[model samples]
Target: MQAVDVQDYARRLMEAHGDKAVAEAAQKARALEEKGKHEDAQPWRRIEAALKEMLGPHQS
Candidate 1:
């Protein structure tokens, strides 16, 4: 998806679940990464990365 789509999804997800969604997703992604399961972590990692990328370095 495009940056715009990522931005929209992040916004909507935040609105629906507050900060918990992003926080939990990031946590899950990290757990996977630490286990060397990058492929399995992709979905969560991508969303977290996209949100951060779209929001910039100071986002979180």
Candidate 2:
């Protein structure tokens, strides 16, 4: 995913899931990966990374 899309999705997810947004994004990525959907999981992985960055090292 593009950086802008990742940030946008991460922001929306954070708003929806609050503190659990990272976990939610991770779960989505893992689920797709486990199902042999690596391509599909890429965006979620990006979002997960973006969410982690947004949270910062001191947060999560």
Candidate 3:
């Protein structure tokens, strides 16, 4: 997905899930990866990164 799409997804996920959004994205990525769905996992990884960026470095 594009950067803007990822950011939009991240924001919506954050609004819905709050602080758990990042972890949720990471978990989705990892699950896809473990299932040998690397391509599918990419977007989730991007979303995770976007969420992390939105949360800032000070967050756990």
Candidate 4:
């Protein structure tokens, strides 16, 4: 039997769990920033911004 490729496996995992992962990441970023963990929070903030850009603004 052949071993499964890790990147392929990760891609599948993300596809299956992407939304939850993004939401959780956003929450963690907010929590970190709120607690004065700005340095650590930078990466998450970038992720959140990118997600927001992809989502666009809500129209209602």
Candidate 5:
């Protein structure tokens, strides 16, 4: 639905599953995007993007 909804869902998912969840979701979204499943990945991509923006750059 809305971007806010996607962000909220992402936050909840992240809280339940931690960082791995975001990584897995992002990977899935990328795979879907490569397959031209843009519609399918829309929510995931939004969630990933929002999470990244909120978390800032990751350092290892």
Candidate 6:
């Protein structure tokens, strides 16, 4: 088997167990964006996006 990048593995693990975190981060991202604090919301948005991707297209 190929060696897994540790950081990537950890990220995947977080994504696997991330439903609540994803929801909260997404909510925060939306709120910040609405407030014109897009820059501040960038990381949260990225996190929400990545975790949602991990959850796949079937997720609600």
Best-fitting candidate, measured by lDDT?
3
lDDT (tens digit, per residue) of candidate 3 on 1-60: 888899999999999999999999999999999999999999999999889888888935
Work out the TM-score per prediction. 0.52, 0.91, 0.92, 0.52, 0.72, 0.57
Point to the candidate with the largest TM-score. 3
What ranking emerges by lDDT with the best candidate at the front?
Answer: 3, 2, 5, 1, 6, 4
By summed lDDT, which 10 consecutive residues of candidate 5 come out lowest?
16-25
In the range 1-60, model 2's lDDT, one tens digit per residue, is 688988998999999999999999999999999999999999999899899899889834
- lDDT of model 4 at residue 43? 67
Per-residue lDDT over 1-60 for candidate 1, one digit per residue giving the tens place of the 0 to 100 score: 566776677777667766576786699889999999989887776677766654556635
Clashes of each: 0, 0, 0, 0, 0, 0
Query: Which has the higher TM-score value, candidate number 1 or candidate number 6?
Result: 6
Q: RMSDs, each prediction?
A: 3.8, 1.7, 1.5, 8.2, 2.0, 6.5
Model 3 CA lDDT for position 35: 100
Q: What lDDT score is found at residue 42 in candidate 4?
A: 69
Better of 1 and 3 by TM-score: 3
Tens digits of lDDT, candidate 5, 1-60 = 698798888788788878776796799899999999999998888888877776778789
Model 4 over residues 1-60: C-alpha lDDT tens digits? 112343343344346667564576578778998999988886665555555555568789
- Model 1 RMSD in angstroms: 3.8
- 4 or 6: which has the higher TM-score? 6
Summarize candidate 6's per-residue lDDT along 7-57 as a digit string, tens digits: 354376475656575677678889999999999887676776666666678
Write down the RMSD of candidate 3 (Cα, Å).
1.5
Candidate lDDT (C-alpha), each: 0.72, 0.93, 0.94, 0.60, 0.83, 0.66
* lDDT (C-alpha) at residue 1 in model 1: 55
- lDDT score, residue 8, model 1? 73
Off by over 4 Å in 4: 1-22
- Residue ranges of candidate 6 with Cα displaced over 4 Å: 1-18
